[model samples]
Target: MTDKAKKKREPIFSPEDRSNLRWLWLGYLKKRAPWLGAVLLMILIQGLVYQQFLSMTESGLRVIFESGEVGQLVLVCLGVFFLFAVRGLMSYLVPLVTVRLSNEAIFEMRRDLIGHLMSLDLAYFERTKSGEIIHRLVTQTQQLGVFFGLATAGAVRDAVTVVIVSGYLIWKNPILFTTAIVVLPFIIWVMNFVSDRVKQAQGQAERALADYMNGIEETVNGMRTVKIASQEQVEAGRLMKGTGAIRDLMKRVQTTQALVMPSIDLSSAFVYVLVIGGGGYMVLSPDFDVDGAGIITFLLGMVMVFDPARLLAQYFGALQSNLVLLDRVRSLYDEQPSINDAPDAVEDFDTGGDIVLDDVTFSYSEDQPLFEGLDMTFRGGQVSAIVGATGSGKTTILSLLSRLYDVKGGQITIGGQPIETLKVGSLRGAFSVVAQDIVIFNNSIWENIRYVNPEATEEDVWRAAEDAEIADLIRRRGDAPVGPKGAQLSGGQKQRIAIARAFLRDAPILLLDEATSALDQATEERIKAALGRLTKGKTTIVVAHRLSSVADADRIFVLEAGQLVEQGRHDELLETAGLYSQLYQAQKKGYDGR
Candidate 1:
């Protein structure tokens, strides 16, 4: 596949790139630009209200020093009341708009992440830790919400305040205004400097957090095993150590980052005092000769302006932390998928289910080999079985047939076309898999079965279930709730349900990895009989653990440590006295021992 095609199938975020989050946030803001304009209008109204307050205060001062009119004083007081009311209302509305915009952005981000994750190749899931994926989906997504809701709004609001307030400051005294605004550059420099340190520490904190979360997930899922082992204290200590690491990382970041606020605060406050003191001297000294009314108005205006400036300093510190989080999220969004289909790839509409491997070599990692110099073929309308010991790359064979991972050295073909040249959707559509580890969702039997064929009617689902010998079980659970992960069902029941799902799919190719291993011998024999009727006229590959399972297959392939050692009919292989014959002898001995 071409690089562009590969990128299209990749997840939106990756661990290495951290800039996508910034782009996503910018995109979200652009989407809500209209609401932002409305917020700006409200801000303008707020500024006008503050100007009115300055005027009212000045008028009252005049009433005290010059007019001495009680009527004028009452009028100014009335204006103050109305101005405060307008300011309050505008403040309330600005936040409402900000929150609405932020929430919409978060919703879009979450949906995009999920959609991208779904499109990624299955190999990514196999390599990446499930706990980490869950952490990003649930915990990191929540943090993203905080970024949108608090940091995004605060940054914009503080920026607006800085602009409006600085304009008012310039109007008061150009000299003081220039000096006051000078501190902003210093603040920016400090923020940028502090952010790098914060980024490093925050990244460490997130890693530590992931470790702690991983422990929690493992512990929760395997609580029974941990308790049975009587290693609860050791586990608790390990968990505590992880949590402690996270706490320490957070403290380091928070401490160093916290310095930013006080530094900016001291600088802003010094500037504020210098401006106020200079203004006060000018107002008092007759040599300066500034008008009392103008001075009073300017001082009141400065008061109105500086409040936001102080808040800006506070929120500037908050922006640093948000930047760190944004960087982390963006890194994930930027990852490239390792495997993807070609743009001009053929989409398989009629799969005869013929599969071939041509001098293929593969490895999950460069340093570790799973397969080397391997070649095999499975013809259509035949049942082929692969038998091997654990870690002998048995399952890897099935994965390659489906193109779950790209072959490192050679090619895999399905229906005479290179699988990489076929669109992923089309390739997957041709095959149905029943893996050793059965996965059942928290849903009714009918719903789970129909998951493989969403358009299938109840009748179709029941028919498939009957073929899988699971129709009677579903009837038993007609009203029974299947708990999460199918916890309510036994292992055998879950396996049957998975088989039913595959049967309902009715794909031209079927791959089974110990599909009946969870069932008792009697149930396995029963299901095998049913499968005989179901798998007719289709290509089938079964990874067998028991010799009995593959005795009836058209062909049996023996693998030991990724090498294909034998391939033939069961009886023919036994007569050859190769790896297959040794396996058969061992199984026969075990059966006779029983």
Candidate 2:
């Protein structure tokens, strides 16, 4: 790769990376220390028992050949059986403990990841794909648990077994054992080479999988649009591209893993051959000191050593493959939320004071400014309306008030206190927003309304539903599921449900973003009355494209190209013959033409 390409690619974690992932692993270990300690103890006992079994087998053979004592052979057999029983129990307990530890750690980590994602600013969601986030939260997290289980628990057990078995071999025949283990360094070198490939392939595979998931998510979410546009083939082809990329990357990863395992096995077999040949020469030589039984023990130890060596090799390969996933997950955890509470944030918001937007300068991007030093105020317990053409910073103003995005310059205050000084939850809790785009979950209408006020009584929910003019429709559905994204409901019905939610909240402040735009004329008029009833004696800000809707508002603010061009009552603004008048006249002419 060129230097530019290398710089563009995100660097995967290496042993030398020394990132907070190390601390994350340490924290998990500390949290599950009891389970970890038990697993380690069990592994140690299992290793010791395995070594004892091998020794007892050798002793039994020597007793039969040299001592000719059947009774002693029986005792040796019984000792081996006892060791096998203990090893079997330890093996079961170790895995049991390790699984428990893994589950607990995965649970906590997932909870923390979800909570962090929830606390993140809305801007993050706007830029990120839901499918990608879901993959990290679900699939990668599970893989991380498996990696932890193998890397820490499985690796330690296999390592202990190899150490014990190798030590026994050296004690019996140092020269032969040393000669046999000489092939291990070559195996390590081969594994290291394969590991680098695995790491690179694994990262590509994860990205491909994430892309595949994104395609699936989009296709599923936009099925209606795809069908209406007759673009099934196009979407399928796009999805196939994602799947093909994933397939190729996975093949590379699997090929690397497949080659590594056999290479390690081949090297181990070669070492066994060397041990057998060398030990045979020593036993047959006149000057040799070791006997047949000792040679047999050395050979047995070599066989035992190979099992763990192969296991460790496999573990290492899996560890390399999963490290890429671990890095992705860790990077997500390290992300800092752009919006957070101030150090001295107020615990509560005084909703009685007017909301003042003073010289508020803001922009979504540096080149395209949305609002520049804009000033406005919504008096306490009064309904104010913002009217403008599309992309004139109407809804953007509401977003600013809610602190979904903070101002780039100047300040916004409520009740004579700067909004940044108020706790995010408390500030948001002061207002109930009914936005243009309503989000309805696959839940019953009652639950959806009660989501904003979980403590609300049944009567209170019904009251709010009636006030929002959705009670009759919900009564017909009863507790029926709304289907995914409220597919079972009509657009106007979904809007009414959202309004019902706002009514259930009954907060001191209200924000309506084209709240009744989806309704028919008759339904809109009825909802307008309900809204008037709902907004009585509350600070309300409404963003409407329909100029007639705000004719009765206490004050109307007209925006043109992100700047406030007119501010007054509806008739007063029309008499001024400004941007507001032009928009009102156009809308009135359109209505009259209809």
Candidate 3:
């Protein structure tokens, strides 16, 4: 396809996208409509009082010039003071209400976003960077709250003020008002043009910020690797480049804003000059019978009109910037999780039975198939081992059995029922997986074990820890901090803590994925003993790298390039001299040479 064709095919905003934004905005307003309505009423009252101040000024001047009674002059002065007081009070209260309402809306949005993120499938996290998600949830959501709460309200209030003041000016002196506003249309056109530029600049700035955040996130996450490789200078240079790009984009947005404010001021200044010059001629010339008070009132009203006009221009620029943030927030809300429960999905499942994969076909992508029409059965209440080299589909089998990813073709059954029909939470709860890549939180050992079962008693925790052969270590630590990612513990200690968690879970099905691949010989032997007891009654599937670990299993399945080529017990497979026998012999030779 040509570049032009591809560009045309790309969608900027579909009908559905527009609908999502409308729905999001309506939802935000619905939650705080009462507070917003009160704010609007206050702003309206303030605008009316502001107009009263202009009239009072005219009346007070007329009273003094005509040498009216002292009482009448005092009354006019008091009325003007009262109007100013009310306007000042309303200005303060409106902002106070707006800020509170905006904070509440932001809190609700954050809570919902977190809940939505939790509902997404595992594959979403696998493909997306954590920093990007964090940026959307934290920075972007905050901007939306501020825009909706403060900027939207301020713009509306400014617009109302401009309309009221302009109406009064036009009512008092139509010819002068019309002459002053002749250049308004051109000023509006310029502002609209600048608004588009601001929006474009804001979009670029947000993208650059995301990139800068990603650079910082990657550096912190891989700090150990960077330090060991002596690449601090390299990482620093990369981050500086990202920061520079963000700074440049932000400067463009600020430059646009600076230009907009001056243009608005210059436009309003021209209108002010015209009104002042014309109103002066009428009051001073002997040809026209214009009173001093009347001419002074018209000039004051014209100044009032320009005040709101300038405010509205500023609000328009701020609104344009916020519109970009709103679009980003709407996009996040529109994302739908790829995996969700079926409409008629079962809510309860019985986990006791064989796990059977019938002619399963699967792959991460279409171009690179990982498994093709494979079949296998893991019998209940038995230890079955899947031994193969790296990338031989061992971990993939375990993932499929757990239904983390559904098969591209065929079906998986547990306890004589199709796994797809089972409830997702209950199906996953059936197994306790202990993998070599253990994840330990920075918490107490006791708390880590109890994470599997929050209601587990202290005695129960101790028993599980003892079974995993880590009770002594826990007792010695006695609730010492585990540090970040269990930095306080050794490799074997971390694995044992994971084992204790699985034992505490007491699930009916178990999966061990290279559970001892990185441990020393003595530690592996100790963990092996605990595993034997743990798998005695449960249906266990072990993915082993070393053939020696699964030599005593009831049966062994050998996989090669996503295909299962051999299955039988230790002696039976050796006699057949197939792939299993070849792998066993190679490992045996290596062990003897060592």
Q: Each model's TM-score?
A: 0.89, 0.95, 0.90
The TM-score-based order of candidates, best leading, equals 2, 3, 1
User: What's the lDDT for residue 88 in model 3?
Assistant: 89
What's the lDDT for residue 343 in model 2? Answer: 96
Candidate that beats the other on TM-score, 1 or 2, i.e. the better one:
2
lDDT of 1 by residue, 281-392 (tens): 7778887755577566776666556566556655655555555566655556666676677988888544775688899999988898988889888887899999978888
Candidate RMSDs in Å, in order, are 6.3, 2.6, 3.5
Higher lDDT: candidate 1 or 2?
A: 2
lDDT of each: 0.77, 0.86, 0.83
lDDT, residue 81, model 2: 85
Q: What is the overall TM-score of model 2 with all chains considered together?
A: 0.95
Give lDDT for model 2.
0.86
**lDDT tens per residue, model 2, 1-594:** 888657533343466334546756686768677767778888989889878877887888789779999999989988988888998888788777787788888898899898899998888888888888989999998988877875667789889999988787777678887788788678867777778788889988988898789889989989999999999999999999888898899999889888877887788788878877888888899888967887777778777888777888888788777777878887886677878999999877679789999999999989998888899999999999999889999999989998999999999999899999988999998989999888899999888889888899999999999998989888888899999999888889999999999889999999999998998999999888889988998999999988898899999998889988899998899899988898888989999999
